[model samples]
Target: MPKGVVRKALEGFQPYVPGEQPPDGEGWIKLNTNESPLPPSPKVIAAIKEAATDALRLYPSPTAAPAREAIARKFQLDPTRVTVGNGGDELIELCFRAFAGAGDTVAFPTPTYPLFEPLCRLHEAAPSRHPTEAFAELPPSLGPDPSPLKFIVNPNSPTGALFEARDVEAAVAASSGVVAIDEAYVDFAPRSAVDLLNTHDNVLLLRTFSKSYGLAGMRIGFALGSPDLIEALDAVKDSYNVDRLAIVAAAVAIGDDQHHRKVVDEVVKNRTELADALERRGFEVVPSAANFVFVRPPKPAAEVVAALRERKVLVRHYDREPIAGWIRVTVGTREQHEKLLGALKEIL
Candidate 1:
């Protein structure tokens, strides 16, 4: 074999492993991915269809004006402090590129969205993983080096455990690093750390249309921060990071608050029912403020996952620290939850 040319940084990079999507399946219940079971608001669908024309020949707006305006209005933030991305994931990678670099360190809680560590490595930043205590608390210190950027997931992925706003406030106040609060699931949660933005210049809040708005395929997400930080991200991002269709879709989705609330309420209902059932089945279910439940079943989580897969039901199985034996299941439709619980009973 010929010797291949690759950067030294590429040698040990471990990429994020998102949940799988099987190609061929019938009657399969997909609960592994945390996507909304609901469809995009009818208005959003109409907007996308309306935009489908010869206009695609032209490049999307370099600024994504309409979408940014909608996001600003919906979130009540200044448009100058907002920047959209291909998705929330891209915003995260952009943060590493803009802030943390060689010799710099990035710290985030363990059992989080796994992309943060590899993103740090790809940017040549020394990424540090701090294991959350039994109750899922950020560690006391920043370790050997001060992290220039700190990422935290509110209603954290997989574990679905929400950090209290007070605790988050204290952590952000204590840290010298820029605190990036990833509120990907905040629509389901009762509160947000975004309120801290008024007082903390170092805080950045990220939002996505993929979950509550049911636009995952649209690949639209936005970041809110101080103008200086927003400018840094904008300088680092491509001239046009968001596309035309996504911008249109996201704007329409944000405008229809009524539909958004209806879907979220349904998901919240299902989430509660699913969590309660799991608890009744002898599982230790975490109190989730997100649209999913992290449950430690009496049976081995891996085995339960495997059995559920065999029965055509899919849920996430984690092998990471602090939550190794737990499973993270997205709250599907009411019918989907009933089907899942029925299968889980057979497996258990």
Candidate 2:
């Protein structure tokens, strides 16, 4: 390749870094990613196994109607109003493609999901980051000229802080363009923006089967919005974006409300217990509504992360300002938490 042949916008573009996954799961308490420590429902597993037949010879449904309808039924929305994707990440990128363009602005709260800014940059859109506490305090003039695209991670990631539905509704009302609410962690929260879809045509609620449903390996996610917004996403998303096995697994998983509730209840319980324990240990832990806790330990976050790694217990650590000293720990199984707590005791 010739020098400088790449697009100028690609220059200095930084990618989103995900949680580290050690090659082997042996002897490691993996809690960096907010994945459910529990396994998927038996029905979901059986559904995937059933789907792995000679059907692989043909292409899957382009619209992924089975999974989409299941999601709609679960949320009590119309099937036409939901668009399933490869994952929540793809749905997020699709929003940028369908709504914003180069030089358009994308807004989100800082110290939230790290992927949003990179997606904006990949599409050459300007990124506008606001403090999470001040996210709803948008200027009156923000909706006019730039036609900003907004992204909200409800029960926001890394920190697990949740914004009330009223706050989100107000932000959507103030926006001229699309507002995508990433609700990957909403099952652990008290409320959801799905209710806002009834009143607001500009709002899109993104969800995943990864966290609550324990289908991370399947990589299925979806978006719920007005029919118009759903159609827009469908227009830009790749045909057959969600494969057959994933569609089957997600559909089965979505239908099993009992199993979903069981997993979520367990995680929420563990989250509370873990947060209380961390607080008791003198860590300034942020109250979380998701399946993780953001904590400011007694020592530097980098040092703690390194020490934990040495002890084979993993947690997320960020190296940015404002939240640079804090670490995010995914609420794991009770036994896993005990191991993490033991490791922390030794490290501290």
Candidate 3:
């Protein structure tokens, strides 16, 4: 607790704040975090249970080979091009270790992923933020930022706005550093930047089982890129960064392609319905490619958020510039959306 005991770089660091996780079965309609509106594939659950054996006493594959192989097969990429992580969030941190460093600049568009700014501070790296306007466009300066590492959150958070594949490729092509395209929500979107991998070795795509796969609690994610990039991620990753059960869960989840498609289909269908419902209520809903809708409510976002909390309805709100007065609401089932809409009607 001593003032000087902590690292100098973390002297006054503020950590990333996640969404409210109220106790389950409390009658609260949770819509803050972009969790899957459904449970994970039954196969993933069964596999995890089967893997919970005396073998747990042994350490998991340091490289998470099974998961890497499964992910590679799913994406039709070579196994060497895959690297599994605790979550897509961990992969973002590892990019800092593998590419960016102290005093190095980490570039990304402003107000993309809030985690990036805090991670930059945690790693003692400088943040090179470029601004985006109207529909969450990629920052114009991003392509020229000579930072050692850069990030692009496709189907970008909060705004949920997706960029053109050509535009994203242009940025990656122009960049002089490692470009990480965070596709954590791509399964809900129309296109992916995976093709950029064939043309550019410096581009890495981060995917997660949390959103579309409904495995947030399992904490499984993977990266796809050139073999060299994956090797660097492996080098910087913690030993057994992903646990045995999680690896099994990932493998089974990836194998159950039918379930994966069902999950995406449901979320995408519900996302469209939810966005339309919000717009009808006079909320200026941003065009979302992800499983959430970002909108400016007709009233003060802070007030609306607080009122909803009083009614046990949770949604994320922003008070900062640019996105101030906007709220991000995760797409839940139709029943949950009804509850949320009812609460908004009462509050308004």
Candidate 4:
């Protein structure tokens, strides 16, 4: 190692590990990543093709204007209050970069998205763990923290549980710093904290086209908040954060409400069915508002995951806090779920 080669920030930083993608044709069932099993809408594909001409030679719009416009129209927010990113992950990173700095504390509920902690660390900020014991349900013990920045994921990850809106509101109202509410899975849920936008200038609402819009490949997401907050994010974001094809495809995806509705409805339906199936199989399944079911299987999560893998099925396994014994299974097609259930039955 060279002297003075690295910043102190690099010492404790850990990168986020998204759920895995199986190697080509190696697995018959893949449910690890919480990605939609459906393909992107045909409209999105057409837009991508249309934008894929000689335009590839030119740089994409730095601000991703059209996508922001479509997102604003879809969500009934002002265009100026909206900003697009490569993915919801980018927005999370940008939040850290924009408001948080070395030695500042970034607080978030434990066992939520793993990325939040990693991002805080990467930014050389102090990462404080505020734990949620019962599927990320804010306990009576949790209230405002002294941290200058907080990240809360509604319908939190891995555990597949929704944080109550009132709990979030209280946290926002009492906290002193920027409150970022990550609603990446909110489209699958009944309501959003967007209504709180007017009441709290410190709040930033994050949404993604990855899950519900089936645009994970295009990698687009956006944030809504006060115009000033949006401007702050714009100041730090990459000049061409989003590519041309992604901008057009994401816009069409946001504009096509019919397609979004259909996909969400199907995901909700399958989520219920899969949860029920797991319950019937003697697993304790958490009630999920997101597109995945988190369950405590009869066997250890690692054992069950390994068994499923042997049967050509893949589900996420985590060795982390708050849900170490559980597995998060994404809602796939009916046939896919059946295959998963069959494999579990055989393993049991």
Candidate 5:
């Protein structure tokens, strides 16, 4: 391990920072990561248990056909147009590998997903950032000439701001290269860009079982696009990316629409209640379309975060400009929300 052996491209690379996960048995109210508060469908649990048998002695299907087919059936897409992955994060990296090359630029809006830039750096691709207050509008600079590989996180993370389907369609129509819409939180939004799939071949819609399906621990996600883009992703991804248990769980979860809808409804209800409560406390709460809300308290964000931690309630705080003063809170169950609000009341 010599210092000079490191790649020059990674000279100043900064890794993505995920939300903090406190240790188990810490008696902490976890509301940092945007995981569903509800558990997965009983059918999903049964499927996972059934899959955890002697069958694991064999390799999983490299193509992940069953899970892909289940996702396609859910979205009314062809099996050839779906690609499953270990998680949405892996799918993002696959997009970078399949489409971007050295010196090519990968573009995404700032204050969106934190992983996009790091993935671009990992691929030795130049990173281009478009600054936006909220993700309600597309960057005017995105078009055919520069032709960068673009990633858009609908109902964006941290901010929880959502862009309309028409805005996404406009971006796809104008882009020369690929346009990937990370719909990881679209289950809680009013509409999805999947409706534009038939008309746009350049758009890739990414979904995860982690959010609404309550399969975050399973680490299963999928992407939908034209057959060509899906083929490219399949070719670049690691073989046997989705394990047997994860595949079975995701398939069952996707097929259980009633369970998924009920969880999403509950999250949406809690989100509204939490936002209203925050606003009533003299905090400026941004309207959220996802399962989290971004709020700017009267005090500095770092101090507020520390205070919350002291009270054994955890939320997320970023150290970036324009958003450093804001904290992102995931909407948990009603009891969790009550605990969070009570903590905030004391802190404020």
Candidate 6:
């Protein structure tokens, strides 16, 4: 195929690049991606192993019915109000498919999930970017923009700062378009925006099993919203967006509340220690409510990350303005923290 064969919308497209995922068993301390240091619940593992049988020849449930029901029970919502996806990323894209279109406007705060901007290009949707000062609050102009779709990444990524629930609700209440509140990191945050669904019909709260559930490899997630919104997503989604194994993992993961709490509690505890260590080392640590800490190192951000990488330590580095000179390190186990701290001490 010729280069010109590509769509005009993505003539020179730049896709979203995830954090460094070096090959496994390579001795790298992977604190770049926010994965739970602990393994998934034993129950989820048992369920996956149990479901992986002759059923492999058959397609999984198209609607991911069992997982939807499980999520509904946890959230105390009707099954019609829930929808499962391959991951939270898929649910985000579904919102674009169901609402925004070519030449349409899609609004979101900046320094959020990098995938949003790339999706805008792929969909030919004009991006209405509202810049935030240090990941503080929802942009005021976002609500009044009247874009067909808007996204608020609560406990926004990279920076790991959780926005106030009232501020998020205010944005949803004021917006004339569909508002997708991405709570992928909400499990580690102090509050959630799920309550907004009751007061506003246009709000959708997206979640994932990848983080707290320790199922990143499973790649499963879900959304909670009015039946109308869920129905729209179901309409645009693939015949079987959530696969058999992933669906099984999601169902059991949501049902194991004890294991879920353990994951969150561990991350929260590790988060405080990681933040304090960074600050004591002269890094300006931003207040974090997510599973990661964002900080401006005393040394150049790029240099620090490169040095750490040389030591088989991985942490995310940012170079764009407003967040330039900043690094985001996921909260890991105490042993991993000591390794990271040692590596940083040598580097700094």
Q: Write the per-residue lDDT of candidate 1 for residues 62-112, one digit (tens) a residue.
A: 878899888889778889888899999989988888888998989887768
Mark the regions of model 1 whose C-alpha exceeds 4 Å error after superposition. Answer: 1-3, 142-145
Question: How many clashes does the backbone of model 4 have?
Answer: 0
lDDT of 2 by residue, 21-102 (tens): 7787478898998889899999999988888999899999999989888888988888999999988999999999999889
Q: Is candidate 1 or candidate 4 better by TM-score?
A: 4
Question: Compared to the true structure, candidate 5 yields what TM-score?
Answer: 0.97
Better candidate by TM-score, 5 or 6: 6
Off by over 4 Å in 2: 1-5, 133-146
TM-score of candidate 4 to 2 decimals: 0.96
Clashing pairs in 3: none
What is the TM-score of each predicted model, taking all chains together?
0.95, 0.95, 0.98, 0.96, 0.97, 0.98
Go through the candidates in order and give each one's C-alpha lDDT: 0.86, 0.86, 0.91, 0.87, 0.88, 0.91
> Could you tally the backbone clashes for each prediction?
0, 0, 0, 0, 0, 0
Error of 6 at 162 (Å): 1.4
**Candidate 2's error at 9, in angstroms?**
1.4
Model 5 spans with C-alpha error above 4 angstroms: 1-5, 133-135
Model 4 error, position 191 (Å): 1.2
The candidate with the higher TM-score, 1 or 3, is 3
lDDT of 5: 0.88
